[model samples]
Target: MKTNVKTSPILHLTYAAVCLALCMVLPFLTGQIPQVGSALCPMHIPVLLAGFLCGPWWALAVGAVAPLLRFALFGMPPLFPTGAAMCFELAAYGLVSGILYRKLPKKVLNVYVALIAAMLAGRVIWGIVMVVLMGLNGSAFTWAAFMAGAFVNAVPGIIVHIILIPIIVLALRKAGLAD
Candidate 1:
């Protein structure tokens, strides 16, 4: 027999809340190690997971709020460029990932494809936001800087995401928590 379970509003809200908490805590936990936090990108993981699990709008809400919340609570990311850029970047990640996951066939390969696409889209959005914000501040953001920060500096996080997200999602599927 096939069972169709529609996600309830309470469940969606709970999941989004949990993922938002994770997004906030992960970065703070990782930030203890100085540059390692930036390299590992702990904040991105939860947003990505939320995108896969909670759908696009929930994911977008988490992504858009995480950075600003963190800045307000901890004052770590500052309120200006970094936090602002991250807001757009993570919203792109959540939006693209959730949409693609829902649209694509249910397969491990499709998840990976969706994830990579989300990563690229998020980075592009980040670059654009950075350029505009920096330009307004009389600073320049070049392609090389974007490449270095988005790709080079984030290699470890990318690798972690590529390896880990699929594992988690597949496990959730096997356990019947993911559809």
Candidate 2:
């Protein structure tokens, strides 16, 4: 039997707030080991989750603001380039993920598809932003650098997201919260 499932703006706002909170806190937990910090990508999890819990617009808002807000609060990530570029990258992640998930059929495979597509799109946006930022700074962003930043170095985070997101989404659905 199909029953109506409705989520209000208040709920979405609540979810986005929780996600933003996590974005602030998760990095502290993961940043202890500098070697694994980038690989683990603790800041990304909540934005991605917001994409699913809220819609693209809310997710985009969260993504675009999270880095800048964090920088404001903690002064890490350095506002000039890193945080600016991340504004676009994380927004793309949340926007693309939410859009794809809503448009595609709700299946386990589709979850993976949306997640992978979002990751790729976000990386691509990050590269483009980096290129522009680097150009403005009178530097070159080479293909090798792009490759290393986008794919090669991100392998660990990619693997973790692939394994984790679907499980969480599926579990939420099972509990009827994600209906």
Candidate 3:
């Protein structure tokens, strides 16, 4: 008799939980700098990976909750403003990635296109919301800054997510853990 070679859903949940916990710990890490600040947060890796692997609801939950928990635990994001912004932005990363991934065909090109598109859209939305909430009418948001911060600055995190997520997803798929 051969045992099934599939991972359990409970295992995936455990993996997601660990990733969320790691995300919550990132702001406390020592390499954080004042110039980039949370703009270059590494927490996004796991959350985005979670969305890619687990689906939208899980990704949304992790993205929505990570900022609040990180602020509460690490105390770097303060309470009201930046934390709120991240709640929207990171949640958008998760939600959009999951939705786009699902809607498009399962190809590497589709995956990358969806990921990059979601990243751009999510950053723009975050910036727009910030401008409105802060009432910075005259001051302009630099799209260059947005691209630099959201993509260029996050290259390492992006590579990490790109490499790790697919492997994890494949493992889960092989193990029959994914839905």
Candidate 4:
């Protein structure tokens, strides 16, 4: 008998749950330095991995819920803008990564392609959410702010993800845990 990750709902649900839990915990590591904390983007890794291990819908659900749930329990990110913006951003990361990974060939290059695309899409979604949320609060989300938040401040996390995610996914694939 053989197991396929894509066809295993229980396995996906378990993985998504684990990813959601990681979202709540990982931020604590970077929270020590408020300056570099957000830049590290601790919550992103598990969410992106969830997309690869689970499928898009499960990953999206995990991504969307993780922030709000974390804020509800931890009160770290605050519920208004940061948490709300993250809801969309992480959702995009998981959705885009899962979708692309599923659609593209299961090769190393395709993993990078999907991961990069998901990161870009997630950042864009984050910027959009910031614009809408800030506008609702009667503030402007300037292009400079968007650039800083979406790319400049995020460089560390981006590099970390680029380095870490594919390795983990590929390792999981080698271990027969991921498709």
**Best-fitting candidate, scored by lDDT:** 4
What tens-digit string does per-residue lDDT give for candidate 2 at 90-156? 9998999889888999888988898889989999999999999999999999999999988898888
- Sequence-dependent TM-score of model 1: 0.94
User: What local distance difference test score does each model get?
Assistant: 0.89, 0.87, 0.69, 0.92
lDDT per residue as tens, model 3, 1-179: 75432234565577679769878766556256665545446777777767666567778888888888888776756655567777888788888887887788777666676676656666777776666645544555466755765678777656665666566655655786653
Listed in order, each prediction's TM-score against the native is 0.94, 0.94, 0.71, 0.95
Instruction: List ranges where model 4 is wrong by over 4 Å.
Output: 1-6
lDDT of 1 by residue, 55-125 (tens): 99999999999999988988968878999999999999999999999999998899999999999999999
Whole-model alpha-carbon lDDT for candidate 3: 0.69
Q: Cα miss at 79, model 1 (Å)? A: 1.9
**Model 1: residues with Cα > 4 Å off, grouped in runs:** 1-6
**Candidate 2 positional error at 94, Å:** 0.4
- Where does candidate 3 have its weakest 10-residue lDDT segment? 2-11
Compute the lDDT for candidate 1. 0.89
